[model samples]
Target: MAVSGARPRVSWSCDPFASRGRLVHEDDAPPRSAFRRDCDRVIHSTAFRRLRHKTQVFSFNEGDHYRTRLTHTLEVAQVARSIARALGLDEDLAEALALSHDLGHPPFAHSGERALNECMKEQGGFDHNAQSLRVLTRIERRYARFDGLNLSWETLEGIAKHNGPLTDRDGNGVGRYAAGLPHAIQAYNEQQDLELWSHASAEAQVAAIADDIAYDVHDLDDGMRARMFTVDDLADLPLVGNALLEVRTLYPGLDVPRTVGEVLRRVITRFIEDVVTETSRRVAEADVASAQDVRGLGHPLVGFSPEVQKAERAMKDFLFPQMYRHARVERIMEDAQQVVRDLFGHFIAQPGDLPPSWQEGRDALNEERLARRVADYIAGMTDRYALDQHARFFDTTPDLR
Candidate 1:
């Protein structure tokens, strides 16, 4: 309800970059601010618009009901907003972070990412989170002078730390960042210091949690609808089956469809409740004249609260065995990787070959720009387009949607 001491200026962990924009929330308004405005900017950005054609699980043509990247992102934003509101968080900040989180994701989820990363490995690895940051900060266009829209620091911090721990250039915490450390943590081992600032905002962590919640449940639903995995099949996997049985015990009359729906709803509600309760307690306890003072807060929403975190962990374990770790998904992933690999090899091997847009460069140095240029070209494609390009260039059979 109220905030504590003067909020420190938000700065990039190592770059000494501070947010330049003003916190523009109206004083009378109970729920909005400049960071919130940043979120709105992301929702309206063109990069955010492309999510509709991106993949969530199945291919574009798999079915109309399947989750597209756009739909998934909307779901993530919705979930994140719910948690933010419950926690008395800056709703706009969470909304903007969730909206822009996936902008850099390639067309085919991790598949397109793998291909792009492999191709650009030498230049800079192509993780979607990094690319999303790149998109918002650089690649996404503007009629204005700069290539990037120059989003607020809050929004960009959310993007960078949405995946894991926020780390400094030397791999230490931002002055006050004290949440869970990133697994396999290392200082920016690379020559380029692209590692996101160590002090990712609490709002960003909330978005990350929202992403996990959205996908973990939806992926199972999608798999079931596609007949890739059945309730019985899922229930048979060791501890997962046991958890499913517990759900059955709780509602004996419920069928698998209803049971799955019930479980998902329960988890969603629990997650939201935990986030709201914890976050509100944090904010209300804070010693606040302004929203700006609340920057760099820790994870307001616990990844797993002591009460439901175990269940959440169990649910994730179940999904891991029953859906994500399933061989069927792996096969699809393999096919996708091959497509990316082949495309990269072909494009790189023939440097003279350029996309129609790149034909104007007339010198040998032009070849040097080819990699970055090709990366730009590939990064902009939707999933369906990426496949088409692969097939067109590789003379492979066209994949049906």
Candidate 2:
């Protein structure tokens, strides 16, 4: 049964009943809490369904077992919830952030995003994080009262700032990517401030770190499954190496598959435990008593220890060349990028070619607005859909096989 009334006091945790409320006001549902409803809404969104066909590390056609965006989101959600539960944070909020985090991702993984970014470079830019905000606040049109999901303010805050503040207090860009805030996010923030200068809730912090953990572990699993690298190859890669050594010490005669599974299990446990321990230590040291305190702390209250962070970086360093930049993956992504570029070009040149809904206000839109609409249309497409559309427009589309 769902808990009713005020959320029980938990140190550095968000209280559902005391939430910042939604952008478009509405009466509350009786049984489910606000955060729980936010989670359910995201699960039912068209964007969520589309993730099943979107790429993670490999294209969908590559194999049946490779991770899709949907699978990755689920893994992130699971990790977020586990961390939330351990830290007495709001699990629903964490899960919602995790599930919704990738909604903005274009097809073909990072390559598609890169292509889209290049296509939109003149019209601001394309960013998955900003795109996610657009997906939640504008693109999703399920609700009659509002175009977007109209999620609670806390959820929106997490969605916008989960990766950390985009700008400083003066509204200037902060990080490497933040120098130019995407138009979508900037427009929304004008109407409703997402506190772009501050950290998100502790739950959001948990979800963000959980995303890092999920990708680190699952990408390794997928890379091995794809034969990009082997277990012995990862035997010297920091945390993974340590996990492999421990697994071998305990289970000397285990088969490769079982050994892989065991190593992953250990890796997950190690990271989760480290996060919980380190976060608890930080909370105590910083005297963080509430979710707001967590957000205002400037630094993340939930993350791996410095030692673990170093090890994780080492793992990523190894994977960058062996898995991400492997010749086969590179070739496939090149084809995928071309498909994105081709679709964007075709649609921009001939706005009439877009679907009736997409071209609804095409008559009055300026060049930049039209380009954004085309970007939106292209961004929403699945990998197979992109290929099919390319086949429709161009004589030869890359096989992407």
TM-scores, all candidates, are 0.75, 0.97
Question: Which runs in model 2 stand beyond 4 Å of their true positions?
Answer: 1-9
Best-fitting candidate, scored by TM-score: 2
| Candidate 1 deviant stretches above 4 angstroms | 1-19, 22-37, 164-166, 169-197, 232-259, 280-302, 350-369, 398-401
Which tens-of-lDDT digit does each residue in 65-168 have in candidate 2? 99999999999999998888877788899999999999999999999999999999998889998899899999999877899999999999998888888889
In Å, residue 184's CA in model 2 sits off its true spot by 1.1
The TM-score obtained by model 1 is 0.75
State the C-alpha lDDT per candidate: 0.63, 0.90
Cα displacement (angstroms), candidate 1, residue 161, comes to: 2.0
